[model samples]
Target: MHNDCIFAIQLYFMQPVTGFSKLSKSQKIDWLVTNHLNDNATARETLTQYWNEDQKLQDLHDGFSENTVTNYYFPFGLAPNFKIDGQLVTIPMAIEESSVVAAASKAAKFWMDRGGFKTVIKGTKKVGQVHLMYHGLSSEMDAFYAFAKAELLQSLEQINASMKKRGGGIVSLDLIDKTKNLKGYYQLHATFETKDAMGANFINTTLEQLATTFRLKASQFDGFSSDVPEVIMSILSNYVPECVVNVSVSCKIDEIGTINGVTGKEFARKFVQAVDIATVEPYRAVTHNKGIMNGIDAVVIATGNDFRAVEAGVHAYAARDGQYRSLTKARVENDTFIFEADFPLALGTVGGLTSLHPLSKLALQILENPSAEHLMKVTAVAGLAQNFAALHSLVTTGIQAGHMKMHLVNMLEQIGATDVEKDLLRKEYADKTPSFSALRESLLVLRS
Candidate 1:
């Protein structure tokens, strides 16, 4: 009965048209032919228009005047069949490459057939830093903290009032004195529970407010000599202090055997090994980190998170071992492939063009109004799933087979293969090989 229930879940989510996993090369050709000849043109056009409208809105918000590099249009595809923890979710991703959406979708389907992915998220706390660079206050550090404590607390209270109604708010503050490079620099750390928002802009803005109040109070003090210390950088720490999200998945061997030669558990083990290599060595870590970012960057583009900030934080964290490491780790345990990804994700929820980009706003809405913390947790899970898909392909079929087949379309186009010629060549080369030399030879023969 448990097995039957699992089957039903898989059927509901994946809804794959093909029942048998194996097919002749001719059969695959035929399938492609049917999709091209009989596909829904009107539906495709509608989607194109939707994305165009989104692009226009993005342009307006970003202030693109035609010569700017701000407008980016990546391929937006939906991973249609995902049942994570018994809940169906259609993940929307904007990426330029092929295979990723399909790979993740198929993996999610396999997990669904076995048992589906389960997830947990830890408590949410955001950290903000205040740099106090005042001369001669080094000796009076204790007095300085005391002088600024009440007003800072009051500032947090006002910030928390709105948050308190939403079931979260500013919780605590920490202070540190003295720095090596910058003499007479004191740091006051503010830890706030940002709830679902990424709380970056929120936390930074709040810290700026407190810093202003502290500066005013410091001027009135007798021992304080430095000009109301101007805040150099006020922003939330990416090292999220709150407990983040956790997810786990299990898939049966028979279920995975449907796809190819290896068992699900074996694939899981190889994936773990690959990720482990990335964690320990810089040589493999670059590609491993790329795979993690492949997932994260797509999601960030979709939801309008500062992808650059995410990239910066992740790459910085990767180099923590004096060398870079993979942002994700994978393992096999108890008939399951366990994957985890944690890095500094300094995302903001409300501020900037997040409110400006219409499609970005739509992307956020599709995610069910996720808070900043919730978004990070979900981001981690998505990265894990994507990493698994990439490594599994690497270990099993050797990643290039499917990838190159898709690239053939581009290679043909690059050599100036027309639509008709491309389709004919693709059909002729059913084995999925791009014979550019052959095409050139054929062109010469036809001229003769």
Candidate 2:
């Protein structure tokens, strides 16, 4: 009995506390500092200090995810002077990166004088799959699927009524045969058009309903006498290559004029070469695409869409053609220097956090409540514009000149420089490249 009690005590010491999430917000923080954090004083304030000033807003933030602690904040800023589809629009961006918003705004202003961005909605088709396991003959499986296809569509009529009424619904359904590769694997691949909603819930709910109906109907089919097809899982696919948008910006090479001493013709040549490197090299492509997504994801988050989903779908599209490649392409044609890109985005203007989060509601209002396609265009433009700015720097003044200059502000804040100290340091680094060590030394000397 003594040995068992000792064993229980050992397990108690080893295991994490159960009911952490069950604790109240204050109690949770108390337990966190007492059990997990070594620096009680610093951890307590650091964790709780960013709490929303409004109690109602804080409560709303706490409900966004599990373990109600404190809200981690991101800077919400705007990039103005974007003329997309002949309308001037200011994009809202939520990010911690110091230069992303500024870079986007610079690019927007540069192109705003040219022709702005022109975007075309290529398609808006999202994909989902109902994976199945059937140990029956391929021919038998095919026949069963043929019968089940129409039935599956009929079964989801109620679920798709509203989506269809909105001019969006199931586009196509096909039976993908994969028996040879996985012994007994097949899929009921489906396509959908969700219109102005991201439609994750709609697609998933419909797929699950279809999966249930498909499983139940197996008994009615003679093709599966004893080899009943098992529904493995039904879920949406983020690899949405068909849901694509194309955005481009162009100007006469001569009208591009001079930038930072480089002639327009020379800049265009070097710019196209930089894009070519990213197109052929995976290492460059990843970073190149990441720059584009910096802008895409910032606006995506600001508008309360799922940036993770947007990211997944986008990266998948980048690697769709066997190797990873750049999303943006550039060239000189007819004395016109053109930079363009294709983005596969599945974003919604409503539902989820759009209506729930106060900031998300404001973001949509700022866009004047765009439709899903319009949002896709603007989001693509943000990415394209961001890529343009990054490449522009890469070809001309070097990325760090502007990037490190912007990062100097962060360095000042990090070293706890006063307003006066920051003002002095800012002027000093206006035309100089500032380093972290240099900033710390400068602050120390200023104080001395």
Candidate 3:
């Protein structure tokens, strides 16, 4: 009978709960705890602990996503002393990684006296596409697309009315044929100037409308009476290579200053060598580029832009030359140290989470409420600063010393060390590397 009862309870929990989404927050938490958490009251308390004391604010956060339970938090840090384009700005970064904010901060101050980062906006035209298929003569399709170009663009005027008033709208809309690659595939490649908006929704909406107009017009066109092109999909492409920003930082080689007892010229030579290795070797390039993104992504997230989309677009841009290489370049010419980077950053200063999240609003405020172009320049500078810090550490006292030193406090907390014990161990391991096991043993010695 006891075994039978155990089977009944297991079977009961195995059955899926109906209308789970419709359940109240309290009911959902209760159900979760009862069914999966082994009735642990602490699990329920953990969820409630992260809730805001202000009910209205808590509700706003909950509505950001579906089936929301609790707010997952990240440390919001500021890296000050960033001078970009003759203006000083403190960048807001949201991340949990150790030593990232510190590295960026150090790099910013390191360059402040030498020369601040210089940034230029290369282009801001974003791209989208409408894909279609039609088993028809290539010549006929080409002529028909040419005829429809004006109408396709005109159809966007109403949709882009507000954007037009803001000096942003359609840049170009043209048909691209890909019949050789796919038997009947074609695309209506479109570009737009989104100005201060990231413009994913704007681009996608424009493409879908264009697709609708094209299919309707194709049904009536003389060349397509027999076979109208079939609309497959309309979406915005994250691979906006044309939308780019250029970031560069340079100063006299001799003025780079001594580092870890190495002369400025020697450090410059080693730094250029390290960047060169990453440029040619794929294995090292991946990590090198990742370090750059660590800075870019942190700012992107803190400002509430789509970091995932930025990541996808950035990695694609890196491999655009048919090979993955470091996104940054370094060279010493005429006794001057030069470093530069160019990459796409489709960021926005408005809309999405920027208008919704409180912290995101603060990030923009900290940035002095920059326009999209300025935001791009600021973010690219962050990436450059982060890379410089990493490479400087690599060619200096090494990465582990500072990185592990930053991790010491966390290690002490994990082992439940007292405040006094942590301070003592911190000094002892300040110049030395430590592992968890070694820390544990030493911790025991302190107690003994």
Candidate 4:
């Protein structure tokens, strides 16, 4: 217990500084390991190279597989002060984006001043779908679903021996009849609690075997081609998945007011209005969702889950309402701003890169083997923070006010401008309308 406490404290203080270039490789690695549990010397040594990996990274000419290249995870940090339902929690995120981490952290701090975040995580259940297309079986759809459910359960008992031992088995089968459409498709949704694992890979393998076994059992004399010809896709469906995590944050208006002239209530109302833009417009929602993912993807990679899978599911879920919109809802009521975000989080406790990645294993240790529900809880908080940061920036100043200035310095330096020359250009471009010719002339004047 003492060691765990010490490690936890160490994790809090080991947060990376804002300006990353100042830190030595060893220092960065130490920070990564202390906070994330997944840092190593190799990651530290190649940190700069990793930053450039997206570009200059060439195809592996020799023996390395495509998986090797795509699987290299980037860890970014989001440190936010938060009190979740009076329980103080510091969120450490690993993402790769310009403003995502900062935005989320700021948002967390804002909500902490009120009453903090409150979350309720449902059971970590995943749904895998088995779709079969039958050609000449207009009347067989009903019978086929019934037989498939029993066979699927039996297969679940055989293959998911571990789940059964742990008192978890295939719970039920939900049949979706979309026969009015082309080819008359049948979707069998297998719902089950996976205990700890994400269960996609395991479930996929099980479903594939079950589909073949069930077809054979239905018609033992010959192949069941005419009746149930082929299985279109026997895998997981991100649609209406059972795995969900719901999180909400409530804080008084006074908690949001930092400006001397502005009351907290007024600030909260303005912030609410800013977030509403994302809810109403798809254009704003895209970037808004991206900011949320910035924090999510980092943790996903750090924990060795399938980030791409989660991303695909989230965007699709966003459009599920017929109109593309925000995944989160925010409002200012009474003296408090209430925020809630819920999404399909099909994260597993084991398998995939979770076992393969060295850093992912270490990061998981930092969270103390959090359940899927707990992980989703953290993700919800992070998303809230990200949304807060974005709205705060846009509402107060403007999108590019700070970011553009920083980028300009980088641009000036890249163009061989000395510190003195860069300073001159920054002053000249403060209006943000400097011509290339004017910049070139200024550079010449500075050199002289």
Candidate 5:
């Protein structure tokens, strides 16, 4: 017999299976191990290693999306003692990066007695666009827009009724002419107040409906009777400049006291200078903003909000004035040190994964079930506090000292150090620079 036929005969005798997707969960695992893996017992053991002890909980997790797979976990940490807008709030952060949570907590505690963090929600308007192409004259496009605008808004009444009851829906729509920039290209700009929801689905639904209404209405209007506007696409924009939050921390220069061996006044001047450099230098601003997002994204993920969208919007806002600059600003006036950051943040507390994920639900509960507005304030404060902590380190004892100290534990774990070895290495690297390769070599020498 051919080799394939012989192999198939052996496989069939070992384990015969068909209709894989229709198999039960246990059966599927059996088939997976028997047919696909060389070491069936080890594969079975490894697959089950990460499953939750509670079958129901594991089933619920498996039901989160198609295809059953094990859960992936990140460290969920809490940064306590955050005083935001006079409320003592403990922020939950989920991240795998070392020292981010520690840095945020340290900054929050440092400013806790120095007036804490203050925040304000400047606006809460999210946007969407219906891109169009009109080869006709500009006046015809203008006329078509003027005539179609009311009908477009009226068409969304049924769709927006439920949202409107909750004090959120289509707020405004405008016809923006982009012929100057691109030939025969224009946009129907729509803005919304989604309230407690991120409203991606809502905005897209509304825009699609508007685009449909515009195309239908334009065909009948005399202005576009010959040339109907072509709808290219309808989607929501992640860049929400109108949705913004401002967070700040201020203290008397004398209250700054000492940090990392630098005196209060000297620290204040250096802090201002560092911020000034970021404002002018894109190279520094990129890292500066990254540090701020480390704190922001941690809180955002913990609450089940979209961190990618927030990151995109905040970075776009940073470069709004033609040059990318520092998100955090520091200034010294009359012996008083002030630091603040203002950036666009569109977040939700009611919809999306917040209600679905158990950890997210618990995180929201731990945050005292804040409203969307309140969450925005808290998230902004987290970013501000993180930036402050990073700057404090950058200007004083330098970024590496504290960063490496926190990283030492990770290094030890990476080199397979035992409890005794970890303890010994911790003391050895107490005042020395910690490096992964060096620690690994030291452990090898000690073992020898």
Candidate 6:
């Protein structure tokens, strides 16, 4: 009896509570505050402060995920005057980075009269895999594939019916041999065209069904009646090399004109040299790609697409030649300064949070309700423009000059400056470099 009581006590401490996942949203929050937080009342107040005031809207947000935590917000801003393929597009970007929107807007304006950005959608193919293990002979494995290929395609007819109506579904299936890498290992590789959806769930569901059908059919096939292939797992691949978009901005070297005290010819030459360094140096390429993602991810989040997937595919594409290199390329030919980026981006326009989240819906509307292809083009242009702007600053007045100027506002806020004090400091730092420590010391001197 004593031992039983001790065991129960140990279990209670090891596991916080029973049926935590099944708890009501309010009950979960109550439990969290009561047990986890240092100050329960203050925690409760802070959490509730972030909630939407409208009851219906709060409920909608609560349904987005488990635990019903308070919303975390980012600044949603617009970079106007982006002309892509001769059409003007004002991009919506949701990000916490201070200078991304400003940089993108500046790039757009710089190129608006210099022939803007151009984009092309190369392909739109997503992928999934069904892993399997077969200890049988190679001949048997080949025979099994021959038999299973037809059955797998026939089995998914019902599943593919609706997708087919929308001009998408399974595009092709292949049996991949991996016996050299891992003993008794194989994969059923499948490619899909999901149209306007990101299609992770769809691809996963289809792969699972295919695995099931393969196992059932193998039990009845002559070669596998006794030893059937072991079903390992099924999943969707985020590294979508087939789904690619290319964006480029080009202008005559003389048309680059002058900006930030750098002549057009000097700027173009330095820009191409910078890109060449990134192409050869891994250390520089990572930062170069990160700058591009700053623009890509912002638009991806605002439009409710999966930014992580886009990031994975883009980075993989960058390293496709076995060396990690810059996604953006720049060159000069016949007095034309050309900057271009070709990367895989499997984004969606009509599914997931696009239909659910209020801001996502508004973001799509702001883009004028683009199709999946159009969204791909817009996202690519944003990335290319951001890289161009960053390089432009780097080759001219240096990055920190303008960046720190914008960052001065954040530093002032951090130092508890009032509107009048901030106005005074802005004038004081107008011609000087701004730093947090310097700003704080200046504010103290002024107050004293």
Cα lDDT listed for each candidate: 0.66, 0.92, 0.91, 0.67, 0.89, 0.90
Candidate structures ordered by lDDT, highest first: 2, 3, 6, 5, 4, 1
Estimate, for each residue in 23-42, the C-alpha lDDT of model 2 and write its tens digit: 89999888777655633689
Candidate 3 stretches with Cα past 4 Å from truth are: 1-13
**Where in model 4 is the C-alpha error above 4 Å?**
1-75, 78-80, 167-169, 221-226, 258-262, 405-413, 416-448
Q: What is the C-alpha RMSD of each candidate to the true structure, in Å?
A: 16.5, 4.0, 2.4, 13.9, 4.5, 4.5
lDDT of 5 by residue, 183-268 (tens): 99999999999999989999999999998998899878886644688999999999999999999989999998877688999999
lDDT of 1 at 114: 61
Clash totals for all models, in order? Answer: 5, 0, 0, 6, 0, 0
Best candidate according to lDDT: 2
Candidate 1 wrongly placed segments (more than 4 Å): 1-59, 62-71, 134-139, 156-160, 178-182, 224-231, 239-243, 252-259, 263-266, 319-323, 334-337, 343-354, 368-374, 433-448
lDDT of 3 by residue, 1-448 (tens): 6955765687576878999999888888888877777677899999989989999999999889987878999999999999887788899999889899999999999989887999988999999989989888878888898788788878888999999999998888878889889999989988999999999889899999999899877876897644788999999999989889999999998788889999999999999999999999989999999999999999999999999999999999989999999999999999999999997999999898998999999999999999999999999999999999999999988988888888887888999999999988988787789879989998999999
- Alpha-carbon deviation at 43 in model 4, angstroms: 20
> How does residue 19 of candidate 6 score in lDDT?
89
lDDT per residue for candidate 1 within 1-448, as digits (tens), equals 5955765565566545573336542344344434432344554444334433465564584463332322446777777566665767666677887776676676666666766666665555667788877666566667877777887788667767887887766778767776676776778887876655556666777888878877777777777565555556666666553544566565444345624687666766667788888889888888877777777787788887778767776787778667778877666656545666655565556656567667777777777766776566556656667777777778888788777776777677777866867677777666744456876665444446
